[model samples]
Target: MKKDPSIMKENMKWTLAMDEVFIQALLDQHYKGFRMDGTFTQTAYNNIINELKEKLGIEFTKSHLKNRLKTLKEHFKESYDFFRNGKLSGFSWNPFTKTWCAEPEVWEQLLQEKPEAIRWKTKVINH
Candidate 1:
């Protein structure tokens, strides 16, 4: 069966500014006790959505925010693991470039096993 185009949702693209605003809004709501047991309440999500719309002039749904949060968490976990794991020792984070710095040989071996990690050489996650 063919799907209805009008009813389908398009992928949401979040800009860095939008993510910053979203995180700020989430933090604000968290301080207000909207987060409990490591999960955001519905009110918190609503507040974040409203804040994003007000600040960025863009409409965002709870699913979009949740998905973005998941992606952010995944990236954070990967960075944390890469640094914390003893196998990847001798690497330092470059605050100036916001990227991880290490010997060429170190990166070469890592990239062989995890090619997707190449993004960290260029892109930095601010959060």
Candidate 2:
């Protein structure tokens, strides 16, 4: 299959330090029960920015945060597995909750693999 240019662009922009931080924040929110419906709220962006500053001691600009979120939403859309009829899907956005959500099994699989850095933070999430 041919590669998607947009996916390539987003993939190239992802830095381990920043992207991993975003992923971990989402996982943290998941454990907090804030995403019972698999939907992660817009508040996650603020949480990520705060955590990044606290842990990395670097300030993350709002523009960068907004860009990351835009890329993430595109990722969620592309990651979905569609059926031949284009009906079956993996994730869908919830406008009311301002979140992206997927079926439990798909969500589990998406999160099962962890970045090495975030893996250690599981302890923090547990507490």
Best by TM-score: 1
lDDT of 2 by residue, 1-127 (tens): 9864554342335466767776787688768765656565567657766888797665665456657767766544443322212343564555455444556675555456533222222222111
Cα RMSD of predicted structure 2: 15.6
The worst-scoring run of ten residues by lDDT in candidate 2 lies at: 118-127
For model 1 the local lDDT of residue 8 reads 43
Look at candidate 2 and tell me the lDDT of residue 126: 11
TM-score of 1: 0.80
Candidate 2 ranges beyond 4 A from true positions = 1-14, 35-43, 61-63, 79-127
Which pairs in model 2 have colliding backbones? none
- lDDT (Cα atoms) of all candidates against the true structure: 0.80, 0.55
